[model samples]
Target: MAKSGPNYKVNGKEYYRVSLEIGRDATGKRKTKFFTGKTKKEANQKKQEYINKQILGLKDTKTLWFAQTFNSWLFEVVKMSDIKPTTFARYEGLYRNYINDSPLACISIDKIEPMSIQRYYNDLFKKQKKSSSQISYLNKFIRKFFNYCVDCGYIVNNPCSGNKISLPKEKRSEAIAKKVEIFTDDELNKMLNSDDCKIKYISLFSLATGMRRGEVIALKESDIDIKHNEIHIRRTIATTAIFDENNIKTKQTIVQEPKTKNSIRDIPLPNSLKSIIKKAKLIRNEEKFKAGESYSTKNLDYLFLSERGNFINAGNLDKTWAKFLKNIDIPHKKFHTLRHTYATKQFENDIPLKTVSTLLGHGDIGITADIYTHVLKKQKEKSVDILEII
Candidate 1:
């Protein structure tokens, strides 16, 4: 290969030359390829492109469009991975919403630059009024897709890397400043004491156990250990999409493993909650006897069942929760707030952070600390107050 040299004027036109080793010749001799450009940087870029093309074994890198590559990566690569179906659906949704018909999708994979990705993110933040967190989620997908491209030798560098793309500082600050909302004591009392029988037991169970709504609904009668006074969490119900032979998507509910290994755990049940469990079981038994053969055999062992004797649909549960809150004259909060309230109460009671994290089935103690930082801060203040007595 020729040595690198400064740009020189050729026939009154400025030009730069770069030499790169292509491969061995037929006689096993070293072979070099030369690239010429108007600037040294441009010459180096041309050489890098040639190396990328040879690595990909593609005669024309321009033939691979971003949209087509994304689709193929989703179905061929990501689908074959060990991710959950719901996750795959989320990936497809992101593609359809952000990348499917966009100008970035039409660009060749080889031409995608960090600036290109930065512009798309900026547009989403400014023009579409997307939240910083939403843009961050989109960035995660794009970054992973570009990483896959690099692993496949389709590209030399990820356009999303090196902190080249990001949300505005104000937007990022806003996101970080947002705090987790928990139910107030008054709101909790109203929910636990509400006359709405359908949501009452489940709401209390959530407050007691800090289990996610999906994990709570996926409970079976056998999961309740009356002898040990414990509740075992093993599975969760998730809504995912199924693609038919022609690629038509149909939504369905499925019982799958917990979100993380730590999510599968046992919680010590309070005696009051045990009694509530027994009452709920008795009521379900009475309903089952009345329904007789009409009762769904498939859902027999499940603790929470709909009127049709099927597992509770997560969507319907959300609606029921909303109506129950409205009837109780409380402001609407997401169902997840129940879980947050339980965690906050634990911290308020001075429970160990590791114990609270374990009960919540958080994958890491740091996650529990991060989510309940405000609660932890209040606890610290209380401890300092005690020290003032000295």
Candidate 2:
């Protein structure tokens, strides 16, 4: 994720920006590293020196504000890393939207206390209307940064070190009301068979394999094994952060590796999707030969393409999903619900939790355990336990 370069303005003034990734954040989230200077050599040199200072535990000038410290640390983490662009984008958005303008960002780094941070989390949830998950990321950053300060000998103790700080718990009523969004088997059959179903192959493939939207779209002919009835999850296509010659940021199409270690898996194709897959293959081959030299994908083998032969983007896919839902007269839900639908179906059919987790490519088995096994947790309170609850 690191970029180093010099660029010019319209008037021909040149400046340089270099990014270096320093470390991970508290929740093991990736950090952002950014540095800019008037000269290319200076910027690059400063990036190296900054890395060295962290490695050697060098003393600072003692003038670091809370915001300044956070920014500096983020700059290092965002640079020169193997983390995904979507991940970097999330970290950047979290910092800019939630942390940068908070009261916590305005103080001296060493002066921050636990109560102040707790109050900030409360404000973020109660006043700012941020989700509990968002507050948790802020807390993660605060705790990670202060822990680093302690390691650097800048503070005697980390204010965010204790076990007392916790994220907002979901209300019992809200938890009860929250429903797992999924299409029933009957609904799925109707939707797939509907005359108005667009992107039929992709929709069916998602139901069969539980691939994410990005993974499904990024599919290439080379990734599929028609003979073996399986597909390899190697890469994903999405709109991600891209840096330009002028060191500014913009969103552009990117094809990158999968998310986690287990995310890169070989999923067996279900018998139900075989016909759809072959139909898609035939259409693509016909399109390729009909257009001949004019075919944009002649040199490539991507299975899905737009009318113009470009990769089908996520926005258009969602639009197609919406259109299909409208034409089928069904309530709209995220396409991700297909993955959930697959998992729920597997659980209902009595598949093992570990097997489900593996099929879903979850990094942690505990995630599968929590989402699929509703009764595994929350036993009746001991004081009010009822015999023969079943």
Winning candidate number (lDDT): 1
Using Cα atoms with residue i matched to residue i, what is each candidate's TM-score against the true structure?
Answer: 0.82, 0.75
Q: Show model 1 residue runs off by greater than 4 Å.
A: 1-52, 55-59, 167-173, 385-390
Q: What TM-score quantifies how close candidate 2 is to the native fold?
A: 0.75
Candidate 2 has its poorest 10 consecutive residues by lDDT at 375-384
List RMSD in Å for every model shown.
6.6, 13.9
For model 1, residues 1-390, the per-residue Cα lDDT tens digits are 998665666788768888988789999999987878877889889889777677766445556899888988888788878988778889999999998987799999878988888888888878888877688888899899989888877777788887777654345557557789988889888877777375788888898989999898899989999899899999999777866555689978888899899999999987878777777777678778888888887887888787768778778888998988899999999988999999999999999999999999999999999888878988988765666777
Q: What's model 1's TM-score? A: 0.82
